[model samples]
Target chain A: MNTFWIILTGALVAASCGFLGCFLILRRMAMLGDAISHSILPGIVIAFLLSGSRDILPMLIGAAVVGLLTVFIVQLLSQNGVKADAAIGVTFTALFSVGVVLVSLYTAQVDLDLDCVLYGEIAYVPWDTWQWGGIDMGPRAAWGIGGVFLLSLLLVGLFFKQFKLCSFDPALAAAIGIPVVFFHYLLMTLVSFTTVAAFESVGAILVVAMLVVPSATAYLLTEKLHVMLFISMGVGVLCSVFGYLLASWMDSSIAGSMTAVSGLLFLLAFLFSPRHGMVIRMLARRRMRLGTN
Target chain B: MNLLLALQDPNTQWVLMGCILLGTSSGILGCFAFLRGRSLVGDALAHAALPGVCMIFLLTGSKSIGLFLIGAGVAGLLASYSITAISRYSRIKEDTSLAIVLSVFFGIGIVLLTFIQHSASGNQSGLDKFLFGQAASLVKSDVVTIMIVASVLIGLTAILFKEFTLLSFDPGFGRGLGYPMGLLDGLLMLMLLMSVVIGLQAVGVVLVAAMLIAPAVTARYWTDKLSRMVVLSGVFGALSGVLGTLISTQQENLPTGPTIVLSATCFFVLSILFSPRRGVLARLFRFFKLRRKVLIEDVQQALYECLEEQAGSSRPGGVYLGIGSAELALKSGKSLSQVKSALAEMVRQKIVAERAKADGSSTWTFTPDGLKNSYLLVLNQRLWDLYHMNQNEYHHVHIDQSQEELAPQLTEEMLEKMLAQLEAYDLTPKLTEGTQAISRLYAREQGGLSL
Candidate 1:
């Protein structure tokens, strides 16, 4: 039952992250996702302190606000002639450091687990059951992650055309009167929401891994965005299940194991994917060379 | 009081020294990364150090700081190499590759970390400090190691400063000059890797990238020259280090790493908002000042054109006639209020005067000084317009000055050429007749202004 719950939590997080990750990868803002994930640390800590409890609502709101702020700051800096990557690095680290300092400063009052934020407590997910009217419900993570995943699905589905157009050619999107900046923040908000909701189970950095690796692998497999989205979600699910089994075998961090499995899948796709595999391309070049000889 | 006592402790001294050295070296090396647009590569290298540290611990079965540093260096380099290879050989973009290598290596490291924690020997390892960094853990040996690494990094950066500068700005040019650009690039990567490895013990892997990034970025706001920027970045880095150490020691349970990062961020924020050259406030000030100047110049051009239109019909009075602010606004394509404000500025400068009309309105007329200035302004505009009209032919000619001092800026040949071009278009100002040479016009203006 614990294994099932853990895998379910991982799958939900992965699916949500993977879906959004496709757009992020296409737009070349993959590191921006990583930055948002790390920077939201302060938001979580602040929410924990302000609300004086481990309530999900305040945490989500806090993280969403900070996440958007991160994007805004980066955009502001880049517009002011700072290099984009440097702006991202400066903003996120500063915010993440503040989060860490805050977590350390009020350790006694906060009672927030730092380890759980970094490495995740997915192994203990099943134990953290959500109860309703004297009835035992499943893991709270599944509920939170499920809600975020559904929201992500609905929003992305409704704005798929806008998001797709913005990702491909922002200039054209703006030319056609689509609100490029609005859709950009909307995507960032969803990413922040998914990251915060999923962080409890997969941790912060692994959330980045879930967002980037599966979508990147799918990107190699197909040229179509819809096909890419589906493949990315499928890859994310595979990572979650296989990662759970691998963690059990190694008795290691489940989130870490999941990330490792995703990396492995990416490597496999890089080497063997039918259309864009490195090994296949090399073989094709070799065959052409042989024929010429 | 506690902070004073804490400063007196030798342990605090070592941590302080270690952090300063770490900051100075990384700040210097960070300039290159920031310049090359590879700022986040430091982040990737920092995260990639984790799996290396874990593997080294597993192999050595010991907890030597020296061994961990070596392991981290090797791992960071390998990760950099893989990132380069992945992007070079595949369709995957550099950023995506960076994200992949960073998260994946970190994931592998986390797995190893948990594995080590669960092991019997894990209790003694204390490797998790590398995650957020605990500067309190630095011993004498660690400080010495950091000192050696810092010296090496600084020395190499100084020695190859020019080559690295070339690499950062234009690698193809360096390659054309037979400078072995590829080898220089790899050496730079190695230096960056060394800095990250040494910094891991102090700032940790998570926030060390900021140490490399924020100081350099802050320095960029201060100067445009490479050498000055490198020095300024190092100073900022070391300053933040000292400040972070001091502040963190003032309070209990304050980890030095995040504090250092926060201080660096403070410097970055200050630089971004207030630096003289590139600061937001400075730029905004310059922008508004330029806008005002442009607005005033536009009003002058509009008034001059209105005078020209009137002079072309029935020569207006020997003296200039007053024009209404409303007519000026329409001619200038500006709002009435904006034109009024600009005219008010002109009045303050004694270039124009507002005369009350019988109908409860006002009109502006140029002063004698203003008439001469307007004539020069109109002549400069016509000269520029003529140059632009023949821009294709005169594209190679560079004209830096276009205000009242325009005639002296160009050489005799180019000025005559431009004036000749202006005469052909019949666009030359009537005040500065095309029949007279520009040199004579300059002499007449220099002799004494008589309009």
Candidate 2:
């Protein structure tokens, strides 16, 4: 039962991140996603300081605000003639440094353990079960991630066409009177909410793994957007279950094992994907060379 | 006082020197990273180095800086390879590959670290500091390791400065020049990996990328020349390290890495705001200067038009008019105060003269030099309008800056060609028609974007 709860929580976080990660990778904003995860550190820490507890709601709100701010700062810097990558590098690193300073400064006053924030403890997650009128409701982390996953599903389902249009051709979407920037921020907000929801089970940095790895692997295996999304979500759930078992066997970090497994999954796709495998492509090129000779 | 006390301690002195050395090398190499559009690649490399450090510790059972650096370097190299391969061979973009490589490698490192922690040998190992460094714990041996690695990195950068410059700005050109481009690139990445590894004990994997980027970006706002930028970046990086060390030493529990990054960010903000050339204040100043020039030009064009309006029916302007502030204000579409300021400026430059009329009202008239200036200003405006008249829509013209001072000083042959061209458009000898052309151009400009 403990293992079930832990794996279920991991799967929920992974699926939501994987869902958002597809868009991020397709739009070539994967690193910006990484940047937001880092920059939200200050926001999360500030929320902890204000509430003086480990409550998840305020932290999610704080993370959403900070995530949007991260995008805003990066946009402002680029508009000021700073290069995109440099702007990303400067803003995220500085914000991350602020978070680090906050963690160090208010070490005793705040309940956020810096070590836990760096490398999360997924094994202990099941112990923090939610209670409603003395009924067992499972771990709060699982519920939080489950709620985020549902929200993402509803939002994506309602606005699938708009998201596809905006992602593929923002200028065209704007010409057609769709609020492209609004959609952009909406996607960013979803990513922020997802990051905060998964913050406890996956840690701050490893959340990027959940956001990028499965989607990138799916990107290799499939060409259709919806198909890629489904595949990545499946990969996310698969990795989470296997990752928990692997961690249990090794008695190691569950989040870390999950992330490592995601990478291995990507590697496998890189080599064996039916449509875009490296080995197959190399062989095709060699055959063409031989024919020419 | 705390700073002074820390400065006296030999241990602090060693750490300070170590940081300075680390800062200088990272800053210099960071200039290349900034130019290459690969600034965040360093962040990926820094995160990727963590597992290598843990792997080395597990294998050697010792925390030797040398072994850790080799391990980290290998890990970073592997990450770069995967990034290049993914972006080049597959449909994955460079940025996606960077993110994937970064998180995956960092995840592996974390897993290895967790395993190490739960193992028997983990009790004595202080390897957790690599995640977020504790710089105050640096001993003499660690500082020595940093200095050695930093010197090698700096020395290689200095020796291959031009090759690096070419590599950063234009890798294609470097390849064309047959400079062993691949080898040079590998060498630069190795240096970057070494710097991250060296600083792992002080700045940590999380914030090492900051040292590589902030100083270089701050320096970029100060200069355009690569050499000067490199020097300024090194100075800025060294200052951040020294100041961060001092401040953290004074404080109770602050880590040096984040504090150093904060100091570097302060420098970046300062440069962006106050640097002479590329700074925000400088840009604002230039914008205002351009605005003043535009206003003054408008007044000049208005004076020339006023003179033309008074000429006999169908006759050219051999006439002069002492226009009042109200008429000038109406003609230039400026406020009365704005018109007065422009007039005062023209008077100071002897471009216009103020006279008291018999009705006790002051009227402004263009002097001889002012007349010549106004005539040329009107001609240039007309020429621009006519130049784009052939196109379906008007386009904004950017005047050659080198010839800006020569606008009124066109030679005999050049003036003849210009006036002849204007004559062909039926715009010559009729001053009102030229003004009409300019108004039409301005109206088109104001309507909407051309495309």
Candidate 3:
């Protein structure tokens, strides 16, 4: 029963991250999410330093601020004539390195460690339960991730039209007076929030994999945005469950197991996704040759 | 200060040498990728190598550089293969396909790393440094290995340079010329994969992509010729490598990859601003010169018109000419001094004359030679317009015969009709004795009788 709750908690958190990740993938900001995952560390450390405690809200807010700052800094650098990829590399790596340094400096005083920031403790998530209204709620991670998921869902619902417009043709949206830059910043902030929430449960490195792989896999499978969203969410949830199972069976880290599962899913999509699969394409070529003959 | 001392130390020579070799080889091969618009493949392949490195470490239980590099190379090749396969099979964009492969592979690598960390292995903690690279730890053996690999890469690129250029510039034409484009493309990918894999140890996977792209992009700003661009890019790459290595070696905790990227960025900025011919400063200078010439021509033409008006109607006072009367100068919106300077330039060209004035604010008039010159300029402009029309309407115009040979076939009536169409745009054809004399001279020069 306890094991079931733990896996369920992971699946819900993973699903929430995947839901937002679908839009990010569609927008071609997969690497940006990876960058954000690395950049949020300093924020977490800063929050701990200021509050002298490991509270969720302050850390989440701190990480979110850093994530937003990362995007803005990347945008500023790119606008000042740095290439986009180069800007991303410069901003995130510098922030991550700073975070590493800070953690090292404050190791004895602070509750935070670099390992927890990097790989997270998904297995230990169920142990940290929060009591709300005198009822024993599940893991603190589940609440945090679930709250973020609801918020993201509401944001997506409210701004579906704007997101679609911006994603498909930002210039056209700008011409039509849709506040393209604002929407872009908003999207980045939302992605940052989700990344921070997901980081606590899935680990930072695996969060990047989760945010990118499922959505990318769904991209190969479908052309429609709504279909992609649903499919990516499904893929994310399944990978979490299957990964937890694999980890349990193999007696390995659940985060690693989940990432490996996601990678396997991505590989399958790359090699055998119906229209875009490699083997099907080879067969199609043989048929074309036969028809020509 | 400490960093500066470290940079000058003799012990850092091997690191510098390795960076130079890596830069030269990657830059040379990167031109092919840049030309093919596959520059981002470096990033994709770098990320893709993570899983291979981790898997090799897990399997071998050893950190032999040879085995690790082999694993990384295989992964890079696999990534290249998968990207090609994805692009061939679906309508997904090349970048998107690359993103997919990059994330998945990196994810797998992370998972494997986490497992390794969790297991009872002590060596796993330091492995993440490979993600960003640790240049300070580079040993003599590693430097030698990089040089050997770089030499092989450079040799391969040199041997296949011609075929690679042909395929890169125009694959369809290369195919028509009976060249094996498939083989060339495969060979190019192989070289790129090797460069990236070998670079992973020194620069690490994080900044290897920047090495490939930054030099190529910087080289593009310096030259239009492919050979020059390749050579310049190689130089830029080597400079970036040396500078980055030096900076990182000096700074205690500074990563080499980011420093290398920063150095390459400086090269890119310098080339954009200062390269000859195509640089920003050159283009801006040319624009200013052209503007000045256009202003002078406008002033001269305006003065010529004022003189023609005075000759026709005995209007010696000529309707009070001012800066507004100078059409080109007025249109350009130059200051009064600039307009005067342009008028003075026309006088120097002998296209206008200054009438003696009491206050030194002279009125301008055209000389007889100037009137004739203006008329010829107007006629040439008309002819240019007609030539453009002919170019658009008739794909080709053959003028093999002289005026006399064409005179009978092209009657005065036909010429009148053509001139009427031309005059609709406000051009008037004058019956000048000089024009007739020139036509006769042209006919004789063509060895045909005058009309």
Clashing pairs in 1: none
Q: Which stretches of candidate 2 lie over 4 Å from their true place?
A: A133-136, A282-293, B120-125, B311-321, B335-337, B348-350, B353-363, B391-414, B421-451
| C-alpha root-mean-square deviation, each candidate | 4.2, 6.3, 8.5
Report the C-alpha lDDT of model 1 over B1-451, residue by residue, as the tens digit: 8878888998888888888888999999999999999899999999999999999988988767789988998889889988988888789999999999999999999999888887758444568888877788788988898899899899999999899999999999999999999999989999999998888877888988989999999999999999999999999999898888888777777777899999999999888889897788998999999999989999988976775555455342333346788899999999999999999899888776676667999777666567678778877788777766667887676667435556777789988987887778776665432323222222122222112
Misplaced by over 4 Å in model 3 are: A1-156, A159-208, A220-223, A244-257, A267-293, B1-11, B176-178, B291-451
> How much of the real interface does each model capture, measured as fnat?
0.85, 0.85, 0.25
Question: How many collisions per candidate?
Answer: 0, 0, 0
Q: Using lDDT, rank the candidates from best to worst.
A: 1, 2, 3
lDDT of 2 at B124: 35
TM-score of 2: 0.91
User: What 10-residue stretch in candidate 3 chain B is worst by lDDT?
Assistant: B441-450
| Candidate 2 lDDT over residue span A145-208, tens digit each | 8998899999988999888888778889899998989989999999999998888889889889
What local lDDT score does residue B39 receive in model 3, on the 0 to 100 scale?
Answer: 69
DockQ of each: 0.83, 0.83, 0.25
TM-score for each candidate, following the candidate numbering: 0.91, 0.91, 0.73
Tens-place lDDT per residue, model 3, B18-134, is 889999998888788887877667778887898899899999887766777899989888888888766666665555666667766766676677778768588765577676566
Range of the 10 consecutive residues with the lowest summed lDDT in candidate 2 chain A: A110-119
